[model samples]
Target: MDLNLRNAVITNVTGNTQDQLQDTIVDAIHSGEEKMLPGLGVLFEVIWQNADEQEKQEMLDTLENGLKKQ
Candidate 1:
């Protein structure tokens, strides 16, 4: 994704209050669990940017399980 579009998405999601952010993230995780590809891809991208190698591996493992559940 282009930087501008990525920034727009981050801005939109993070604009919520802390509680709302938590709710939104929870909803997103459930969406990811269902293998909603676009949602999962967006999350994976964000996690990729911020996660360390070990964290990345953990996330990938979670994602693998999530995909299986789907």
Candidate 2:
């Protein structure tokens, strides 16, 4: 079987509105299921690719802070 998880995840959310997207993300995180990680990762990859350097640094800083809390 051939699987393209990133494409699948992107396609699933392709036409979502901002509220819908937020709901999806919130629901996924609340579920605390390992299966949702790849979908979140694909979303993060899209954000990272589109983000400017300053935004990327902000994300990195937030991630670092989040890790510190764990």
Candidate 3:
């Protein structure tokens, strides 16, 4: 079976409000389920695609700082 996970995740959250989207992200992170990682990756991909270079740098900095803590 072919599963287009990125498309599925995008479709599932397409019309969500800011609050709804925030809640979904928070819930997914808090759940810590491996299945949710791909959905998060898709969301991050959307963000990365839309971000400018400075925004991308900020995100990378945040990720680096986060990883340093672990």
Candidate 4:
């Protein structure tokens, strides 16, 4: 995993406006850079930390479904 991606993204995570946050996610996903995954993992960690139990379950279900589609 990219420790640099984690460091770069995590430090600037505070006070992100919605659009900026969306852009970060979108760019990371669409960048076609192999190193984007750790950034996504960081984002997922942020999401996971903030999610409630039901939401977490939903995320897990979604992930499971996506994996099954592979």
- TM-score of every prediction relative to native: 0.56, 0.93, 0.93, 0.81
lDDT of 4 by residue, 1-70 (tens): 5678677878877689989989988998889897877777898998999999999999999999999999
| lDDT agreement with native, every candidate | 0.71, 0.93, 0.92, 0.87
Best-to-worst lDDT order: 2, 3, 4, 1
Give the per-residue Cα lDDT of candidate 3 at 57: 100
Native-to-model Cα distance after best TM-score fit, residue 20 in candidate 4, in Å: 1.0
What RMSD does model 1 have?
A: 4.2
lDDT: worst 10-residue window of model 3 = 1-10
At residue 30, give the lDDT of candidate 2: 100
- Model 2 scores a TM of 0.93
Q: What is the lDDT of residue 28 in candidate 1?
A: 75
Candidate 4 all-Cα RMSD: 2.0
Q: For model 1, how does the per-residue alpha-carbon lDDT over 1-70 read when each residue is reduced to its tens digit?
A: 5577666657777656879866766787776565445543565588699999999899889989999999
How far residue 24's Cα lies from its native spot in candidate 4, in Å, is 0.7
* Candidate ranking (TM-score, best to worst): 2, 3, 4, 1
RMSD of each: 4.2, 2.0, 2.0, 2.0
Ten-residue region with minimum lDDT total, candidate 2? 1-10
Model 3 bad stretches (over 4 Å): 1-3
Better of 3 and 4 by TM-score: 3
